[model samples]
Target: MRNHTSVTSFILLGLTDVPQLQILIFIFLLITYMLSVTRNLSIVILTLVDFHLKTAMYFFLQNFSYLEISFTSACIPRLLYSISTGDRTITYNACICQLFFTYVFGITEFFLLAAMSFVQYVAICKPLHYMTIMNFRVCKRPIFCCWMTTLLIMLPPHSLGLDLEYCASNAIDHFVCDANPMLKISCSDTWLIDQMIIISAVISFLITLLCVVLSYMYIIRKILKLPSAQQRTRAFSTCSSHIIVDSITYGRCIFVYIKPSAKDEMGINKGVTVLTTCISPMLNPFIYTLRNKQVKQAFNDLVKRFKLLSKN
Candidate 1:
């Protein structure tokens, strides 16, 4: 078995080999990437500039928006370059860096979502104590811990990949430097790493999902107890957007990462990856804004201010 140190670069076999299809995919992904960045950045800016959005909820939303931007950026730019230039060769170190950052951002999103769910739980189930529970200090701690813990947890697995021997073929079958695809190319024994990945994925998903479910369960129970139907509707509406986003994010992630045979289905894996990495980030701003009257109003106010500045 050849040491990975000798393998300077690996070729990426992207989504399709057809030249025409590559161009089409390039255009489509370019548009998707741009829209994702724009929408996410808009949410961040809106949350920052709007006085009405200075609450803990919007603070969490802003962090989430920034996370989405970083997450998609890590995956899409390399993908775009591969598709547009038809040059899919990535150096060994570069691939490792890509994998590391991707997992870092991906895991960070999990914790961020959990934090957001907790914020929603407090807001709905304990409205009286929502502010006290999710004040600036309390809210900032989770975000800080989420990023720090993700960095620490992800480093070991990524370092393990760096230590792998790559005597086998250096062609990655997917568009991104996904864990399983990278492992498939390694000549070293990957059973331990594979098990580690599976265990980690399961644990992370279950723990965060349990938190979200518990939060939502309490939220639903509280909403059901409301005497007025209109009050119940109003309470439910506030969380509907978060629930939708969480469903899409977690559904795709679980299908791709948490399954026993996840690595065996490259086609479905790529499709699901695209949904989570590209499509979901773009959809988040629209879902949050459309469902939220306050965000919509803030967005409109920002647009008018922009127009006034342009006229001047």
Candidate 2:
């Protein structure tokens, strides 16, 4: 048992062992971080400034973009710093902070995506009562509720950390501070902590997954019944977007949280966490551009504004 002063820091093993290769990967991720920040910030600004984009879809999209920006910023900058300097160690408290916010945003995202799916379901399936029910307040309420719920869930992870004693290794296996990897170092029985995490995982997955499935089921049924070819095409178009977003978020998340018995498989799960944390932020802008018309117009308008401003 080594001297333990609160497991004050951690070491990260990122990318390649070769210095040259690590530098190259760092540059690539640096470019990605730039694009993620620029694209997501652009969406946030456009959603706020564009009068035509005041609809419920764009409103929620703005929130999504903002959250993605926060999530990526938290994860990527640290990873980039590690890559450049080869100093992957993060302070123990800092590691906990990272773990806390990562899950908070992640779980919030889980619920938010379901909420957005529900919004689309209402718009497509119950077109008659869409405006009446999905009023500004109703939509905004869930956004607040999901984040508030996320904060509450974050407390348990922090509490679990407080209970653990780090008598052995302090080096985290992966690039960032994650719950399961962090728990792997604990010199204490993790029965309570592991059980709490398991329960949280099951509850979040079942509730959010069910809501998305039901929403889309109704969405598909409504699309099939539409009389005109154009309406049916448009409805299918929208449904496809929701389905795509759902697949990306839920798939990576399910893989990350759902425990496997093998250590090798667990390593694989940790590796793919980069997908959830780093890659997903990049996709949000593309999702909006590909699926939502208002975002396209907003992007075009923003480009024109910048060009005109440059001429001045």
Candidate 3:
């Protein structure tokens, strides 16, 4: 790690400079951050405690929930703090740490989503063998691999970023310590690292998305082959939640990160990033739970248990 001797800390040019807008942004972020953490944590807790949700699908969901909580927490709280207080100066070490965790958790989610899609495919396309294929022991392997794969992909570029010399400007555009903005301000030759970052992102996106698409193709085909309309509907219904979540997860990321000149639209990108990190996490629990009967039933049972304990 090259010592960033000249620049001890970077000034994060948060969302806006206007005090009134800042107040509103702070309040909005505060509510969303709290709700995102709570709802995602609720999913994690429900999956752990609810017997009805003990399947492989819920296992992947529980991991996804944990990822949602972690990914949002990695960036949102820091932004909230920056908005609330006037403290936008993040230290060199702190900024690097933030960037690392943000990328790790965020990238890991793509792999996990692909894993979830595979679980869905097995459940739908190979119902007879679903349990044997996706049992608890078998399920843990993919989840472990997801994290390991993400780390392997992310570490090289992230480490290369640390050696970036910043003698000139430390005022990072937009909120978090994102790679693009940090790269914009760095005084080093960033071509190689930039390509590496883009390649890593593209590789992650394409590989995971291919898994999702192929899984869904088989799933759809299998669903169509069911003789009765009711059976097809039921099968599709089981996958509806995953499909919606996948669309949102992949769509937003593609819009924000896939482009060559991501730094060009820093302003628009920040807004999308807020939506990605804040609103999406808060909304996902609702998206997954509201459309599914099993999760709702599990939640109601959990609520009743809490109520009975309070009375006791």
Candidate 4:
């Protein structure tokens, strides 16, 4: 076991080793990051200020916006710094902390989305009980539970990371540290830790998948029983967003981390990992919130309120 005090830093093996492409990536990522911040922050503001958006749905969204902000903050700034300064190195302690938070948010978000889907399923499928079930207190608990549960379940991964001996090659294949990548750099035999991580991740992923699948199964059955076209349309509209976001997050995540590296397809796997961490967080705000009329209305009202205060 390597003493934590002895290990200093790590090197990132970013998207392309090519200097020319680094510039292009920086430009593209920075723009996407900026837009994501602006959009999510806007959602956060609207959720707080708009009385109409005080439902369970927007309550969950407020947490999502906050996570998306921190999620991007965790990696994008480091990527920008690495690109501009050619400083691909990070202190080993900082690298592990980053990886932990990234994993925390990813897992938490998976279950949060599942929780949100179930909430919608209940609201649409059991309209009589929607208000009783999804009150403010009831609503926030599920999202918060996801965060707490994710942390509890992934304790082993964190323990492994904390005690890791990283005396070997410090060069990480991605700009940000992740569980698989961080484990790859361990100087000690990481088979136990790797199996622990894979088992936990698979179990977490499967549980979330089951929650979403069952929620939608119930939702679909409910939707079919509805006689009104408008009711069915509304139900489809709510669930469709979940289907899109889940497909992106879980689809890419499964591709990236599920396969053991002894059977690795490095190129394809790496691309999927990047998409999950980098691309999906940016798009999630849009897919889940921006297209909704309620969100748009809240935002517009916020702008109008600001302008009225300015005139006063």
Candidate 5:
């Protein structure tokens, strides 16, 4: 019989084994990380400094951008280090910490997105009552709830992982210390953990997605009823960017976590995870700023301020 012992550290196999490809991957990820940081930080700063962006929509967007920065930071730096140094090993405790924070940020994003959808619904459907309904006090509640609820919801699965025995091979076939990869390396039966993950993912995904869908449905109904065709176009334009972001974020996430197991498709899983962790953060700020005229004006205003300060 094979002796079983707790793993002290894990070896991350990373995206590719080829040395040449690793360099290319490192360059790609470094550029992506820098861009993600710059774009998200710009959004947060712009939202704070620009009076025009103080509405509930920008408030939610700023929080979401901050979350994106944090979420990408939690994984990308470590992945970059591993790629650069050819050191794929991570301490077990570090892996657990990474896993915990990743889920917290990821789950919080769903709630935030739903909250943003609610803001859109109010802005479009009840324009007259928008300010009254989505005041600062009201906006703060959902943000707080998103953070608290996700923390509580994620604690169980993270704790469950801490209890599992990892006697099997410690080589993880992905760049990040995600739950599925961690579970795959555990010698102990993870049927319970697997079920827990599925249940949590399903409930969270469905509830948030339902909220977004319902919000958009009501929005569409309201838009269609508007007498002016131009008004309908404007309403649809406001939502199109959000819909794009939602599709990218939820589509990849559902593909990864909603399944019974992702262990079998390590290659595809890694690609999708790269999109979620690296690409999503980079894309979100651009989507919001470039697609929305208000944000573009805000950004341009900020630039002019900087230029004026420099001249002074």
Candidate 6:
């Protein structure tokens, strides 16, 4: 791959060119990145230590939190460093690594969210069989499949990316090493790989989205059929957090990647990418924990345990 390309390093243009604006962007990204990592890490720790959280729902939540941490960490820290140091140049290998990890984690998240939707469906629509249906062994299988399937979907395009020749330019137009921006700067015939990326992204997006939609359809139907209003509300409440997260997750990605003319919309993509990579991750923990009674109780218990340990 290195031998084929004349460019040894690519300069990331970053979010802005103005030095003063860069400072503001850097501070914003820094604060959000710190908060995102801390909140997501707390979720991971809470799920692991809390006995009450030992269920299939929380198992998926733990993995989702991990993905949030990883997806944001991949993009934001690098941009923050570039903003702080005035060094926007990233090595060829480093750029590829960033692109690879970001997609792998981000795409796996779509599948995981779909799996979470199915878990919700079973818990609501099949209350008697919920535990038996989503047992520990059953829970682990979807998570594993999500990772493996994402790899299978991502590897071919990424492998083809290695053969791309970049003699024309070395400056990627976005803040991160995204595929579209990288393709725009390459000298190779990117039409085939570009189409492939779009096809894979659409296929992934639609299939997972269909799973979520279908699961929610069944859940809503079950809730509507409940005898009491209180029973319906209680059942619906359990799904609210997942629904909100799913909306934001899918909405952002669809705006960026699922459009017919995404490549030509670089200006809009940058802003959406910021929201996707930084703002969304920071908000997700609050969305789940604040809305979720079980998670909140687990968090409180964990905090109490810490205080008791400190006093001793």
* Best-performing candidate as measured by lDDT: 6
Q: Residue 133: error of model 2 in Å?
A: 1.6
Candidate 6, 191-249: lDDT as tens digits = 88988888888868999999999999999999999999999998888898889999999
TM-score of 6: 0.96
Q: What is candidate 1's lDDT per residue for 1-312, written digit by digit as tens? A: 344546888898888888888888888888988999999999899989999999998999999899899989998999898777678999888888888888888888888889899899889888899878888888899999999978777766777877788775889998888888888878888988887787777756788888988989999999999999999999999999999988988888777655457455898888888887888999988998887989889999999999999999
Residue-wise C-alpha lDDT for candidate 3, range 1-312, written one tens digit per residue: 544447789998998999999999989999999999999999999999999899999999999999999999999888888877799999999999999998999899999999999999888888899889999999999999999999999999998998888865899997999898899888789999989988998879989999999999999989999999999898888899889989998999778655556455887788788988999999999899887898889889999999999999
4 versus 5: better lDDT goes to: 5
Model 4 lDDT, residue 2, Cα: 56
Give the alpha-carbon lDDT of every model: 0.86, 0.81, 0.90, 0.80, 0.89, 0.91
TM-score against native, each model: 0.95, 0.93, 0.95, 0.92, 0.96, 0.96
Off by over 4 Å in 4: 1-6, 257-264
Off by over 4 Å in 5: 257-264
lDDT by residue for model 4 (1-312), tens: 554335688888888878888888889888888988888888898889889989887888788888888887887888899999988889877887888887787778888878888888878877899889999888877877898899887887688668777665777877788676767767778888888877887768988888888888888998988999998898788778878887887788667556666555556656776676567777888887745888878878888988999999
Ranking by lDDT: 6, 3, 5, 1, 2, 4
TM-score, candidate number 2: 0.93
Give candidates' CA RMSD values in order: 2.0, 2.1, 2.5, 2.6, 1.8, 2.4
Residue 61 in candidate 2, Cα distance off native in Å? 0.8
Question: How well does model 3 score by local distance difference test?
Answer: 0.90
Provide the lDDT at 194 for model 2: 86
